[model samples]
Target: MADQRQHVQGTLSELGTPLARCTFVIVDLETTGSRPGEARITEIGAVKVCGGEILGEFSTLVDPGVAIPPSITLLTGITQAMVAEAPRIEAVLPGFLEFAALDRGTVLVAHNAPFDTGFLRAACGEHGYDWPAPTVVDTVTLARRLVTRDEVSNHKLGTLAGFFGVGAQPSHRALDDARATVGVLHGLFERLGSFGVDTIEEVRGLRATPTSAQRGKRHLADDVPESPGVYVFTDAKGDALYIGKSANMRKRVRSYFTAAETRGRIREMIPLVEGVTAIACGTGVEAEVRELRLIAERKPPYNRHSRNPERSVWLRLTREAFPRLSIVRAVRDDGAPVVGPFRSSREAELAREALHHALPLRQCTQRLSPKKTVPACVLAEIGKCGAPCEGHESPEDYARHGEAAREAMTGDPHRVVEALTERIAALSAELRYEEAALYRDRLAAFLRAAARSQRLSALAAIGHMVAARREETGWEICVVRHGRLAASGLMPLDSDPHAYVRALVATAETVPPGTGPTPRAHASEMECVLHWLDAPGVRLVELDHPWTCPSSGAERYRDLTDWDRASPSTTRR
Candidate 1:
């Protein structure tokens, strides 16, 4: 570690305030260099203030142990040779902190503080003196806030001193600057009547603007409001800090903000925060779905789930109109076409590879985004994409087929069954039993998918995104979305058999309308699934258990694990 670091720990805890506090030292340094990494402090000066009164003043030239820059020679009368025999920070910093009595509520007051504080902290951390230093207030941020244009054009210490007719005498001398700073702070504090900065305890207790910002980001977080949707906090980086889902998003989110008023850590976070974002959904169930999808995309930092958004992509229907098929991609880029409007070749490749499954469209060779000059894949000859190659199919036809596939993957799975049903009816009417049987088997598989769709629908009803995993103890269920956690329930081998049956039913229910299975549809399946997942005796468990019930291929349990890391819908804004 460097000498600067010695001051970090030693002075970190030593930062404090004035008033009912002990003496604070406003200090300044004239340096031979711009950065602590290379620059050496040429001069150090301090003015001690206690109970709003100057207690003492001190200034000194430091033997930089290095040659002073010519600029330094012109600016302050200190020369290259003047400080060659002077004291170093090792000798001066400790005395400064001691006089400041930073260990006793004495804060450091400086201008453009981070630069100086950063240097000071670096020094403390290095010396092993570990400053345990008191708080350092930047007169810069304070003066801009307190001095306002009506009183002054600039807030530089020299400017403030000039306003009070003190002029910059002794000019760049460290002691003079420090003295001038203390005087300026005193004048501004008296004029403002109050610092207007209440205690963390006082601000935490109120849900109003905890920290000021634009309208969108104000303190609407008192209680996550009463609404069905997801809530988010986005920092200045446009990165999500947290995400949550609730029928009462207002109240739930508000609960986190208001409830933590007493937590010092939370108080610090609230003030640094920019604002919150929300997505309103159709139902609390819809909110959960949307939340899961969002969590999958926007990995807000404050969210435990936020970290996972980038690693996983959800299977989404690309075309959505007709040739129903699935594609794995981040949600935000959905509208950008693989077939048009100019897209990169890499994205097209990824879209195909991720969406590639045991399905027929897996063999496409067509370029994605902005229809390409080359068209179709080898599978097209066999009717996979209607042979868009060699102009056998029109661009409209290609789009239609792709649309159909996308639609099949998205819309109701019933559409697949309906199309298959028509094929089966035509085959049977032609008395082609063998072909009809093939259609029948395909229909069975289609019917299986339809049943699974019902299970996904039911997951939403319970206001959760469920991911069941096996553990040594039993099955663990992680219900989450975005970065916010909704619930984690476990199903142990020792649990009630009835609840297990219900879970299986969600995965095994008969098909709904329009599929090749049964023509009947029931609205209650989702409700029943909700009742089973949430029944009181449920416990949280890991899903890796050996004896857990098997899931059909359609059950997206793998997605739970992957999406546990996968970003929800990717963001555009």
Candidate 2:
């Protein structure tokens, strides 16, 4: 029985800090006014509780540095004489902050958190003391979730305290009110337990009420282990309806039944879901990669991302006598420079147009023969093309333009930007503002795709790499091969990471090389890896290759144009 109880506690702790193990400093304050700037806190009181027992208490009267208001004094019975010899807020704040110990997993609780925390933060700011942002819990919010209007007239501290029959009662005093709030917090926890909310995260995310469908489907998540992983919602035939990933598998699955699951499509998908399949992963990044792979393979109806990675288009130089820019779905190893795995063909076309504005490459799609001269289209007359179709530009001459375009696509794009900028400036000077704006949009579209392609290529060139990031529990280590997440694992706090890294690397998935920048891996997966690598505190554990990108990649030219703002729909990755 003792072993079983320990097992249950251990399981609950894995989700997050279990509510029973959390230390809460219930606080209450009396003030001269309601709002922060308009008010001054007069009295501060707190009771630190862990596992329903009081560890210590902190109470102090603060001098507001101003006269107490008559209405406030009358309500709280704190007369001006009562605080004449009290310590100023500067002295009192340090003691209060020390007692809270917010940095050491001590959660701050208040009846109305905003009011108390606001005044405290305001006081800290005014005195030039650093405000340690604490994880705060509001008893009023918790009570409203558990005790409806039918059970209590209102969720005020006094009403909740009286309903719970706590030892202390609110008497418009800080210490008494704080003591009353602790009891109300404990009472709410009792109610939350019935709903299977055992962790601090669950307590914080508790909803007022759950949908009937959500309540009925709660059992679907019962078998999910408490770990980071991917989850699949399946219909009766065991086909996937939706797929998702989260740091905690059990917590995320259970949340689908709560009111917090508010997405319309997901709400609709829930009624059809007959079961959930959980795949435990070693880290959050691995779960994300797994979710993307599963979604692409299964094509889950409810998943929008990575569902159609094959549909991505690219802008590449065609293999012909007079090679022209073409939008293709698949990349080839023909050595022609390719620009994208664009989200859609429309974006690829936009990027193509931008490149055309820089180089007078032939706009025609038909095969052109250097030996035979064919009549050129009107684009040749407009000088938009070098008219290779009409044999006006020889294959040798067209090759020069193609090589320049190739340089812009693969290496530096300064010439492309300079050419476009000259045209835009010339148009704007001629009062052709509309034409200039169009050129600007095209430039942004091209740069956005180029920058994303370069970033993806840099990471995808590496054969094998291992990286780790510091987490509360330990290090989140990942094994990446050609920018694909091969495997992930955790090294417990205070343990050597070398052995764990070796084990994870040995068990990682074997990935084969593919053609182009993002070899063997989906562009989305590479982009995810780039984001993780760039995040703060990530340490490179091992690397087989020196990962690098062209210094003149389009990313360097972002400051030269308002690309991000003008081309908001520019597809990345």
Best by lDDT: 2
lDDT of 1 by residue, 62-157 (tens): 887788778888888889678877888788887877777777766678877777776767767766677665666676776665567798888777
Which of the numbered candidates is closest to the native, going by highest TM-score?
2
RMSD of each: 17.9, 7.8
Q: For model 2, what is the C-alpha lDDT against the true structure?
A: 0.82
Worst 10 residues of 1 by lDDT: 7-16
- Each candidate structure's TM-score, on Cα atoms with residue i matched to residue i, is 0.35, 0.76
Q: Write the per-residue lDDT of candidate 2 for residues 401-429, one digit (tens) a residue.
A: 89888888877898889888788778877
Alpha carbon lDDT of residue 423, candidate 1? 65
